[model samples]
Target: MAITSDDVRHLAELSNLSVTEEEIEPLKKDLGAIVEYISQLDELNTEGVEPTYQCFEMENVWREDEITEFEAKRKDLLNLAPESTDNQIKVPKVL
Candidate 1:
């Protein structure tokens, strides 16, 4: 695939990049080479081959969700607070 200057300019615009007039020719050549290289994958024989999504063996280890009682009681926590009103902690009023 041959990448033209116009293609490079369009790609630059889509990518929100500022490409100089001198950089366009080099970018076109580089991009053309990259596309050609990637196109070589079409020549591979992938028949009956399962697409491997992950290279490493992975699994989701799940456990039953249980609510355990906290060691500190509500009264204990309220006592530790700087200021408490009724059964809740009190903070400075905000606008």
Candidate 2:
């Protein structure tokens, strides 16, 4: 499971990363260590253990859906915005 320079190069190419020659050795060592650690995990003795998605036990704390009394006009909500366009809040273009 040890990672070689060629393996690192191939992975970098697939990921579109430009790994310099100086960085290849460190990356190879790091990747090799990770692979070795994961390989060791494969030797576990959890024959009857149940597969769990989370580490801790969890239960849904959902509340019962019920209509709640609330009073607020549309104009009151719109007045909080710094700028509005055609009864809609204006936001800056991100993309």
Candidate 3:
């Protein structure tokens, strides 16, 4: 696919970039070369190759969720708070 000035301009607009007139030609050449290089992948022959998802042999290590006792007590935590009422920390009202 040929990268025209309009294509470059459209890309710039989509990317929220401000490109000058001087940068248009260079951008067009650069983008065209990149697309051409990537298009080489179309020449590859993969008849029965499995698509790769994860590059590494890694998986989720899940463990059973168990409730554990905490060292800090509720009363102690409440006392450390800047302000607390009704056994809960109080903060300034937000709009």
Per-residue CA lDDT of model 3 for 1-95, tens digit only, reads 89999999999999999999999999999999999999998899988999998888878878889888999999999999999999999999998
- For model 1, residues 1-95, the per-residue Cα lDDT tens digits are 79999999999999999999999989998999999999999999999999988787776768789898899999999999999989999999987
Give the per-residue lDDT digits (tens) of candidate 2, residues 15-39.
9999999999999999999999889
Which prediction has more favorable lDDT, 2 or 3?
A: 3
Give each model's whole-structure lDDT: 0.93, 0.90, 0.95
Alpha-carbon runs more than 4 Å astray in model 2: 45-95
Q: Please give the range of 10 consecutive residues that has the lowest summed lDDT in model 2.
A: 52-61
> What global local distance difference test value does model 3 have?
0.95
- How displaced is residue 14 in candidate 1, in Å? 1.8
- Candidate 3 — which pairs collide? none
Best by lDDT: 3
- Ten consecutive residues with minimal summed lDDT in candidate 3? 54-63
Off by over 4 Å in 1: 47-95
Ranking by lDDT: 3, 1, 2
Q: C-alpha displacement of 74 in model 3, angstroms?
A: 26
